[model samples]
Target: MSQAPVVGVAVFVVKGDKVLLGRRRSSVGHNTYALPGGHLEFGESFEECAAREVKEETGLDIKDIQFITVTNNVFTEAAKQLHVVAVIMRASLVDPEQLPQNVEPEKCDGWDWYDWKNLPQPLFQPLETMLKNGFSPFPAKLN
Candidate 1:
């Protein structure tokens, strides 16, 4: 089989002043902090993929989904080189009081909410690039 880039949907599930992130236990970004997202399913909209991945990975529901940005990531450190086109999206939690649960412990250590200005170390490739470019998923406050 030939290597081909895959489209991955990443969600910025925000609550109050924080956004949800998890420490990945998967090979793509092992031990690196990342958003709750996964590969985009066939025929699914970006919003749909975001919602689904959030629920699957974090056991949380999100609403007000909207596209934010995209990034092209190529990882060569792994035994198998990987390339992914990350579709970034932002969404608010459906239940503001609900806490994230690590639904897929095999793939993620656990989920935590962190302020945008102070994220944890060793971010996933896409997220690292996004932050390096000064991209904040939080929407601008309207007066």
Candidate 2:
């Protein structure tokens, strides 16, 4: 059997120099810090996927969902391999005072904003791929 790359939507919810991340509890990258997102559903726009997944996982409403970049990531497990075309995005909270909660504790530990330049250790693979390529949502224009 053959498999195709699935679309994985990830959102960077930016506030000042900080972005939100959660410690994943899922199998794909268990225990690694990752952004709020999930697989895109059929017929759903990238923006819609971004908004829905963030809200579903973190209980956070976001706006200004903008296309950031895409990374082709391939993961391998014993006798299995998965490929994903990760559609990365950037957004802001609908309300600046809105706090993130662990809406889906089964999937993630919790969500909290962290400095982009000083991210948490053991980042999820796809995110690590992005950083290795010099991707920074926050340019000097942000500060």
Candidate 3:
């Protein structure tokens, strides 16, 4: 029997025309760009997980966290099958002036702002699922 798919929360922080992203260095999506998120901790809501993950990985507090979409992602890499249930959310920085930094240098290369239309290549699977399903994080004002 295989293990159950892990549940993860992906927080999309939009500022103007760009969204916050980080290049992953860990196994699941190593060398691929992804939103700042991780496994859902026990007793934490999806919004709570999004906020906590953003703060933990990006060194910024996120506000207005709202549910966006969910994706069931299944993929195989190097003959190892993996699956994940991804909870996607949108948020903004509590302080606009606060910049994001790499809080987990061992797991991530760094954080950067990328235009939605020009996202970096080799995106993490969950994120690619969102994009393929027409998920957009840009605020109405910017869209």
Clashes of each: 0, 0, 0
Comparing 2 and 3 on lDDT, the stronger one: 2
**Runs in model 1 lying further than 4 Å from the true structure:** none
lDDT of 1 by residue, 86-117 (tens): 99999998999888999999999999999988
Please give the lDDT score at residue 86 for candidate 1: 91
Residue-wise lDDT of candidate 3 within 1-94, one digit each (tens)? 7868989898889987899989999877889999999899999999999989999999999899999878887767735777888898999889
lDDT of 1 at 63: 96
Q: Among all windows of ten consecutive residues in candidate 2, which has the lowest summed lDDT?
A: 134-143
Write one digit per residue (lDDT tens) for candidate 2, span 94-132.
Answer: 999999999999999989999988999899998987888
What are the lDDT figures for the candidates, one per model?
A: 0.91, 0.91, 0.88
Best by TM-score: 1
Model 2 residue 3 CA deviation (Å) reads 2.1
Which structure is stronger by TM-score: 2 or 3?
2
Q: Which parts of model 3 are misplaced by more than 4 Å?
A: 78-80, 139-143
